[model samples]
Target: MVVKLKLEELKLASVVFHHLWTRRNGLIFQDVFQSPSTVTTMAQVDHVMYKEVLTKDSERTARRQTNEFSQSWKPPAWPFYKVNFDVAFDQASGRMGIGVVIGDSEGELMECLIAPKKHVPSVFQAESYALHRVMELCIELGLSQVCFEGDAKVVIDAVNSKEEDSSWYGQKIEDLQQIMAGYPEWKIVFVHRTANVSAHTATKLAIRVSSENVWLEDDPVEVRRSIMDDLVCNVLNQS
Candidate 1:
């Protein structure tokens, strides 16, 4: 016959059993059963253990539901369009090249390259030159509201800051400031190199190619071809 005993007493016995098991090695249940105090302690321990297991299972189930709900949810749409540009300077040749890609909320609109008249010596200079040319292009295209992004932090900071009058690139800085002033709703930002890879590749190609300039829409094949050519040349030269 099965007997249903009070769980409170069983739990007390379990608690005593747990303490004895932890304190000594090779403990036998016979020793615990023989002691009246130990039997009561073990009953309490078992009750606590059962409660803890139930609590843990409930918590795990709640977490699983929370994760599922989060995964099923969608985020709101972004409000503004973003444009990214990159510039590469050939210090030895003194040639400056610029590459820009414009995109709206829908998708990419255009990409272009400008081979400057004078060779730019530093990456910062090339970046500034690229920004200037991009602003000019935007004006030509009749775009009023846009944002410009580049990989050069120093150039971006210089464009955004008021502490001008630096000896190096003073004229170029002033020209950029004037161009920026012309646009009422334009912003400049610095993007990481990885994010600016396409433009960077285009800029490098612009510098390497014999043609004065190359422009494309929505990352065209010609642009990719030129970039691939540059990559092949680089790899071959290294080998």
Candidate 2:
């Protein structure tokens, strides 16, 4: 049985449990249970979960969510850097814009990267190259524990797959897997464009720079505002 909370009663609870979901969403999702213990960090909930068999088709409703109640740009736990990447293409010059943004545990910007490429044939190719470049940047920084995400569902799906993807970007996916294998722990997931707005905005900044550029601890004026917006939203989710 579940207990109901009064409008006033919820104000006194240690933590309030909101929308519930099953494990089949294929997300490294964090959930809260109304246990007697006080809620602290996300990792604290791991001990309360159990495995169960579920029909594959039962999760359709979970995937078809409307944007009304969703939260975007969720922050990572301590010591882990969360990276989000996105790509934009210019048809006039056949150039692609790629953006990568890294945020630390406190939702503070760590790095911002934007690059442009010519002769990119499709969005998938641009996204694939963006992922490859992001991984290379992470490797160069010697970052091991990380959570990598992107707004492109197709690209994120292929990056998270263990089996070799045979689509048009087959070789690109293969190379990404090889680079990821070196990390001790990592995550690759897809987020809605709403949640990935900071990275998406950085892609627009690509138009300003003539070549690849990296900025540490700071971003362009537009992306800086976008990052700050996500950071404030993160604080609201925790409260």
Candidate 3:
């Protein structure tokens, strides 16, 4: 009977069998397998498995998915930065807040923005405006490569689609697409609320202020803790 074993299971089974054989007889795998070449093949399989899935990086990824700190801002690739935006809406006061924070590949804060919008009717409107600020900043800074992220699925879906625009913010969305068309390396994505805490903090701060604010290099002390927490998370993932 031929026993078909999966590649992973075969490697595991061979490794276990070899370990036991070496210990029991005080001899190497060559004597147990009766094939000198088998030792090299098993060692190669172990090495490949270690590099592919059994390494420290892979283990950390699994832990991150299940851990409480799973919601984290992922760093962009080199030469590209990530912009995370969020909106705060206050229907009672007829005001909206747009927060945009940019981070580099090393998880350092590159830029921060707080734009307080009036006449903003709904959450969707606020989110769309936040998207607008994010792109406008990217263009002004001559950042051609960027990753725009937000927690609002409605805004992300509408912006990323090439479909006909008809929403209340459709016109502005079209305008954003045109501005972003100049930068082929830019993209918009939606992330979990947890991963969007930094931008949310900025939005909350905007509610207390009356004017548009921009931080080119240093983030305000109010949002520093969240940024520090995010940087710490990134560092832990590397280990």
Best by TM-score: 2
Clash count, one per candidate? 24, 0, 0
92-209: candidate 1 lDDT, tens digit per residue: 5557767666655444345566454463334455667778778887788777777777666666777788986544465677888888898878888775554455566667666666
Q: Tens digits of per-residue lDDT for model 2 on 3-72? A: 9988445533322232112221212433423222322221122111101002212333455553335548
For candidate 3, write residues 115-187 as lDDT tens digits: 8888543455566677877787888888888998887776678678889755435676787778778889998
TM-score of 1: 0.55
**Candidate rank order under TM-score:** 2, 3, 1
- Model 1, which residues run further than 4 Å from truth? 1-81, 114-118, 166-168, 214-218, 222-239
Residue 203 lDDT (model 1): 70
Looking at model 2, the pairs that clash are: none
lDDT scores for all predictions? 0.59, 0.71, 0.74
Q: Which lDDT value does model 2 have at 117? A: 91
In model 3, residue pairs whose N, Cα or C atoms come closer than 3 Å (at least 3 residues apart or on different chains), thus clashing, are none
- Superior candidate under TM-score, 2 versus 3: 2
lDDT (C-alpha) at residue 211 in model 3? 98
Candidate number with the higher TM-score (1 or 2):
2
